[model samples]
Target: MKKILYAIIPILAFSIIFLNMFFGHLVFESETQEVINKYSVYVHLLSEWQSESKNIIFDVTNTWYKSDKIRNTNHVFDAESKEYNSNQLHEINGKSYVELKHEFSDCQEEWQPMLYRKAVDTVRHEIEYVQGQQLSTDPSVSVYPDTENENYDNSEQQSKIKNGFVQFFPICTSKDTTSYNFSVKTDNKDLGFDVYFVSSSDQRENFVNSKFDYYTESGCYGQNKQSYSGTCHDIKKDSGLLVIFPDDLKPWTTKVTVNLYENN
Candidate 1:
């Protein structure tokens, strides 16, 4: 009886392990398919000052979630059925300007613009900044209207808003590594910064069954104890650390650590 029981114990344990593995794999595969079915490009609005100074106050506040990186981010915006309108920014003098833009991806390459706005949504695969636009000399400060009134437009009673925001297009890739750097040269001293290269992984075998690149940059935007947020797409990496200095201080430096977050 002892010998029989021992033989049966190994068989029973093996059966349990097999069942768990099989079910887990099936569940993962199902999830992956769903994401692909809903893939589409989305327009994500970002303020240059918010990203640079690290003072991004917005969060998951809007009814819809818009992310350029994540799949099925279209829940944030709708060009069809006219679900929501008037997604624009206000100016200082009470005028309104629509800082509209577009994104291009395999998922949303065919989407067209609507009649309500001047520009329709488009796509650009890489992280390319719109050329010829001016970059703020004072990176520590962000320029935006103090109040939010949705109905106002450009007229005598309208607000005085200017085009100060920069438009960036996110590029998706399977590359193993990516990098960006920043530097400042002053009359009194010269200082430089580096965002070292890091690794990326894709653990979602249940979804696309492919790897996504991860990237990181420290102090690339600005320093003033600000906050910012954006979507990371299929890849994963730390947003980074924030640091601030006094106005009188001349020189400061720090390194950004980057690592990839793969699917598990």
Candidate 2:
């Protein structure tokens, strides 16, 4: 009897030790995996934020170029005299070209600092929230504002038209077909204008020269109104141009707002 009891005691002790070690390893592995998944999510969020910041900077730079072009075309200055043509500098909301340029420069200077601060705040908040909650490994699950699901892209530009015509080129970032909504509102709603979306400069010239009887027949999307709101989906290239001219061939000034949305 004594011999049998000693053998059973040893077996029971071994079994207890083995069971404890096995369960401890499983718990440890689960914790490690959880941490890894959380880290992956954090990294993904940071990458996405960085990409968005780059896009913002790119858009701002492009806008600056476009605005500069419009200013040069409308506000012609005598090279020798260093004098701006008073007739060409039309004021909108009492803001002249100089004032607008100054404001734009200020905005450009602040963008980087604002973006950096936002990135830091967003990451810190996310880290705290993640530590208290079970986060999914899916990269799409993010606390930051989802620009894709919301406003894909938006831009506003003000142009003073002295030649009775102006053209704006907007970039299409998406590889696939996307729809762009344009809202052209002017201070003078009674002053009607013509807006055309053409794929090429030749097409624009043809339209401007009245080569076609109808805009649709000319293979261009167009609107004739004092203020227009419409969508254009024929932008198949990396960029598209919007040509605007007053209906009465008179000088006009207006503000244009463009909103880009992608199809699901």
RMSD of each: 22.8, 22.3
Question: Could you give candidate 2's per-residue lDDT for residues 108-153 as a string of tens digits?
Answer: 2111112233345457447735763213232222221111111111
User: What TM-score would every model get versus the actual structure?
Assistant: 0.17, 0.33
Give all candidates' CA lDDT scores.
0.24, 0.32
Candidate 1 residues 81-168, lDDT tens each?
Answer: 2322224463311222233222222233222212111111111101111331112233211121112222332231111212121112
Q: What value of lDDT does candidate 2 attain over all alpha carbons?
A: 0.32
- In terms of lDDT, the poorest run of 10 residues in model 1 is 56-65
lDDT at residue 155 of model 1 (Cα atoms) = 37
Clashing pairs in 2: none
Residue 238 shift from truth in candidate 1, angstroms = 16
Q: Where does model 2 exceed 4 Å of error?
A: 1-163, 209-222, 238-241, 247-254, 258-264
